[model samples]
Target chain A: MAKHDKDATFVGDSRISAKRIPNIAPSYSEFPGKSEPFWPNFLLKEWMVAAVCLVGYLLLTVSHPSPLTDKANPNDTSFVPLPDWYFLFLYQMLKYPWASGDWVVFGTIIFPGVAFTALVLAPWLDAGKDRRPKKRPVATGIMLLSLIGIFYLTWAANDEHSRLHPSNGGHSAGGATAPAAPAEKADSSFKPDAVWTAQTSCQGCHGVNMEGVAGPNLQKVGSKLDANQIADIIKNGKGGMPPGMFQGSDDDLKKLAEYMASLK
Target chain B: MLQKMYDWVDERLNITPMWRDLADHEVPEHVNPAHHFSAFVYCFGGLTFFITVIQILSGMFLTMYYVPDIINAYESVKYLQNEVAFGVIVRGMHHWGASLVIVMMFLHTLRVFFTGAYKKPRELNWVVGMLIFFVMLGLGFTGYLLPWDNTAYFATKVGLEIANSVPVIGPYAKALLTGGDIVGAQTLSRFFAIHVFFLPGALLGLLGAHFVMIRAQGISGPL
Candidate 1:
């Protein structure tokens, strides 16, 4: 290293003169034409934009509010499941005839996988100096086509959902129903006991109102199986129902069994 | 008084120059809205990051009350929404913030692509950004199941089935995600741990790399 001049004023503890070395690159040295300070110059605008976003976010929260629906019931085959809006395009793609059954991978994996891989490799895929969309026709065209495809798929998904469940008022993605609305009961007068409410896991295979879905209708089960038989079946899984599905203690199981037997 | 305190800390830590370096840095004029109205497009990335910060803060508050089990998960969310003060607001912020962040990220990606910012020296940054995007999607997917609602259960069922549709590792991947033959307690626990811990950690690390790369490359030149 060359000896520093005795009178040279260094920056901090460095031997190099503070004025000798430029802090930024040559391209950035002349700030007036191409750049500005990041602090008050740029950050002030950022703060303002952030404030607007915050206000808009608050308004959206207050207006619609987040939704909370009924607790999960694995046995509820009647319920139509829908993913959030962002995933809606892919969800719709899986419904295509070619994408179903044996070709399911085309929609779920292959197509999406290819698209994502292309996106990851986009920098190299269209490695050219031209930045303007007009100059980069291929890249721009591909982007536009993809956007159109996604938008169309999303719209179709919403349309299909509405067609399936017209009463649902069309695609309630964000507007989920309120929590714990009592599921429709077969016999309105017959009230559900505490055991029934707590052990709702039974509703997974059995119907929400014990009217039967995948399982046999238990509304008149007492006429078919006695309490002991029902308890036996509950303890040891019967037919399609899996073993140890009922998670409560033996006493709760007995009560549930007895309750099932009395449903007639 | 504040200046004196800052001076004392700066003297001990030798931080003034560092602070000045950061606070007085120059950003390309094209990124400034005053330079051109089109420059507003650059705001999307910063907005995404801003919403992400809000998400982290609100998500922390949610964890205080959220229970990650089959039995209590739904009920706990209910209690928080109905009973806890400002709980609805916090939860709502997170809920809406998730959607907003994705929207902003998509817009940011579009802006970058249109401007050809992903070309050449900035290619690595683009890859890192895409990783961050996928992590954000992962976060959205995992967080969707946290409430343990009927919609969540069946939607997740559909998602897992899609995973299972893949040829070779499909079944195994589904089994790992489900944690068993079914999407029950184990699945809930797995998703909860992943949503709260694994993906967020990955997201932060990726985001840090993304920012450092952007700083190093000094934002791509104008179109």
Candidate 2:
């Protein structure tokens, strides 16, 4: 090993003085340093901290629960495309004026690529001798700016998301608005629209053409029950029918019920 | 008898000195645990590891009941949440653990950066840490689609579409990820494979490298 410089900082066992680098801050070697055995002391502290954190995590898991929604429906278009909260900043970045369509590369690539590269290269680029924030202007400035930018972008994205979907979380409630009722008189031989009534759902229990399988026969249902009674059953459900089975707007349900009433 | 057994193992394995060396390693006296951010640096790192373990265990539990098929994926998750005992809590832990790990990793990275710990011989460690960070994000993105809910389906569509916007190789990458131009059963399968296999494998490898470097270098001293 080369002879150590009395004035220089220790650069590992090779004794290569680190003070050779220019623009370096003065060494703190003048202040006497202290050291301790890593065994019992540090290990015990680390294990205690780990135990505490484990307990905290268990508590959190016990206290909080996950949210869930209905099954995946490909046909339903009301669902708004929202990424998880962690990615909301990037998601919002894509919504920028220059970030949409042709200029998307700038947002997704150029900007992020530059920032990431800068982060990876910061040690080399900002290797000032000082570790204090005040002494390292460029490093501190960059860190603060990036932090502020991320937070602002995240807030803006969340705000824009909330704004885009004023009523719901961008989810258009399937049956929120009532449909315009038909102006003409009730047709005695009315055959409910299969597509509108979602016949497959009804056929699951009602059998082919409402002849009844698990549910009562609806072939002459009109003679036994009024339209309002049938509508109640469809909405609230009865013995066999599950509530919310009729997946349609209010008008569709009312029309289907009326058509069933005319079956007799 | 216990001491004899320990001696026998130590004679062959030579574990005692190695452990003592690790225990006796000196950190700079200036490392003040009382400092707020300095403490958080360690706290968050520990939390990140804890959450990673929790995620792995909970995810394994979920897989016991979760059917990854298009028809049953959503239904299976519903059953797990509603029917299986402690399923909701386990799933919740996994869900929240993913988010917490990301947050902790981000904070740890920032702490290292601002503290100038990434300098000198530690640069390669920083690079490895970045690789692990990106892998963590990959884990999050892939795991998001496993539930196969409407939110998961559409978010994935948008995510893949963004991948499609990358100049030349974008479309191909998107196709590789989604298994087509759209998010469907194939996309779900791809995500499941990536989430459980690829990302975790890559993460463990990168993390091994990262910890090895950190251990060899010791914690960087306060500036």
Candidate 3:
């Protein structure tokens, strides 16, 4: 090793330490520097994650209570947009250039997949000269591009700058304004032509011709109950339903409920 | 009987004074824990610790009402939220924190890549990180299914179908994930087992090794 330094004396920067890899035995270890805890040395990494997982699980159970609905309510649409926060990234993704179907899914799902794939393949990809990042242009370029890609998609999903977040985190005076248009859209589902189109998603699951797969058949559901009961089943949700029946709008629930009743 | 066995083993062991009795050596000045790579590891690792801790605290409370079986899974979640103290917020924190973990892991991996940290000596560690990444993804998959809600049910079904779409190993992977066919009792059990036992167990060792390797190798600097 000392001899190499002597040989490289002719080269300009002798501090070209690629890495101090050992060339022996079947295996080796790669531990980093020994540092005390970031704080007063109380909790370590694993313990912290373990703690968070425990707490999060507790909270979720407390708020929603598992098995709250029965039988995975397919016909019921009473529930609202209560997606898991982890999914909000994608849920938010759905709003992205949503009019363009393929690009939307790509921005949300496929893009992340490709980026993670690249991360996995990084070792095989950039196997080149110097050790420091300063020496590696190609590798650096890829990382910057990836960061930009993620930022773009995330922004595209929830353009907080848009009407979505008018207050920049402050509560809107009424906040009623946010869901009005969407609510009206839901109400539009009740129109005769709209009823035919909207009920198909229900038909695909509950029964196209009137039966049940994951939900009860809706052949004569309207005669059995009034608007409110049907609305509860549609909006607040029922057994086996995903609570997607209505999203922050009674108008949508009315539309959905009326349509389901019309199925007979 | 166990106490006697312990005593017998202790008597046979010659290890008494331990490392403190042997010698003490001070670390070099440059070998601070906050070295570039060490700081780098600390950044993500510290975040993982924070997130996992939140998961643990929230999960314990959830278990109060979280029935592992399919029959009551949805109901229990509702009960916890409506009945348990601070249940909704805690659950939300856990959930939002999960998304945070995935994001942090991605950034950490990127840091490792651009810095050339996974070169010759650190190849295997990089592989371990990859495994960690996949395990996290699996965590998302199985955890989502546990809710048994519509989005969870349908999305997971989509995910399972995708898994099953693989030409040769599709069925096997699907079965392994679902524990059987659809998201029934068997599937729920399988996911719970993976989420609680298998993934955490695997991660413990991987995480330790990952940190130790980071310590041993020293962090790679900025690209």
Candidate 4:
């Protein structure tokens, strides 16, 4: 006969009795404690997570690359600044203009700031003691959407092959990478805004295909340096290279590096 | 095979709670029944944990090719993306996830704060949570310079100058982080140790304490 009033607060007071709960019988009296018991459920779950992560990391670390690369070279201009795969989608997203003018910056930087601010303000927004998802729709909605966004974006970044599927015979404004080879002329179809977004620094020095008009041919460049070395050189700027002196940031390097790595 | 595959799909889709009945959902009469202890805490802790795990993975991967010295630090990152297979992916994940972690941790803190989840008996827990936030920022600050590239180099220099602006302790603090007046091998190693070893260890401890306090205090009151 227990019911929640208008405030949705329960009617009973003092001493929580699990027996009254339909899920657990009233006959149940004991609650699990830390020292008096076997492994706690939370502890077991935590350990399970830890174990899986350990295995995944170990496999990744001990592989052919050995998870360690060469030292930082300040002189390598061809280096790229790619970040981890999880961030690639956002990195990819930033290449696109969201609104006008500063959309890329807003999408990449300010959007994340808003999300963090919302997260920090979560405790206050949800003051009710209700522990049910159904009870807190806004918080619940934001949480679910955020998790989906994170997982989807990270997963999407992993699928490079997905990018190659032909959309139109020519290029579409859909992708960041140079469209399939047939789209060489399709690139010209891009709006003036897109063209004006950010000039490829590589084009300034290394020619379109890195044909060595300004620097050296990058077609065979992949053979010269490993992935890590290339990233360092691109980021650190070596020899005569001006070190991404323009449009340089963490995300910029990763995107540009991925582009250079794809050159081969 | 079809049935098994369906079951597999079901298992992954079973993230939503299906078993809790009406009474099982209840707390004390004074407590708000709407607050989901599982969802709130789980969302915060789970996201934070996942991000940390990402950092560890990406960070570990970076270490595979990274030289902890001033001279090699920059080249190492380059080597990872250029030569190593899928190294770009790993580095991208690490870099992005670091920013995401900082963002999520702050969000988790905000949830705790607005909920008044930090008051009274939980004030000490609140302090621990604050400590976790500070350490996360510390993680970002130190990790940013690891690339040893021009951006990292100059940004860090600006950063240390900001540090040195802290009146008397600024110079020493700057010295401690940069290993002299400038960034070099000592600076890289110092940042690496603080990032991988020192700060992470402290954060893990604080996180544990934060969780313990939550369980002890139950969910905070409704507004």
List pairs with backbone clashes in candidate 2: A39-B23
Q: DockQ numbers for every candidate? A: 0.49, 0.37, 0.14, 0.06
Quality class of the docking in candidate 2, CAPRI style: acceptable
TM-score of 1: 0.78
Measured against the true structure, the TM-scores of the candidates, in listed sequence, are: 0.78, 0.73, 0.55, 0.46
Candidate 1 CAPRI level: medium
**Model 2, A1-264: lDDT tens per residue?**
998567444434443333332222233344456444455555565667768876876676666566554466665454466777778778888888898778889987788888888887877888776767778888889889989988888778767755654422432221121112222233445444564246576764555556544355576778889999989988877753567777778888888888888778
Poorest stretch of ten by lDDT in candidate 1 chain A: A17-26
Give the chain A TM-score for each candidate. 0.58, 0.52, 0.32, 0.40
- Among the numbered candidates, top TM-score falls to 1
Top lDDT prediction, candidate number:
1
The CA lDDT at B48 in model 4 is 75
Writing each residue's lDDT as its tens digit, candidate 1 over B1-223 gives 9978975655455565566656766888878887887899999999999999999999999999999999999999999999999999999999999999999999999999989999989999999999999999989998999999987888899888888888899999999889999999999999999899999999999998998788777887777
Error of 3 at B141 (Å): 1.7
Better of 2 and 3 by DockQ: 2
Winner by lDDT between candidate 3 and candidate 1: 1
By DockQ, the best candidate is 1
Model 1 off-target regions past 4 Å? A1-34, A168-264
Task: Count clashing residue pairs per candidate.
Answer: 1, 1, 85, 69
User: Model 4's lDDT to the true fold?
Assistant: 0.56
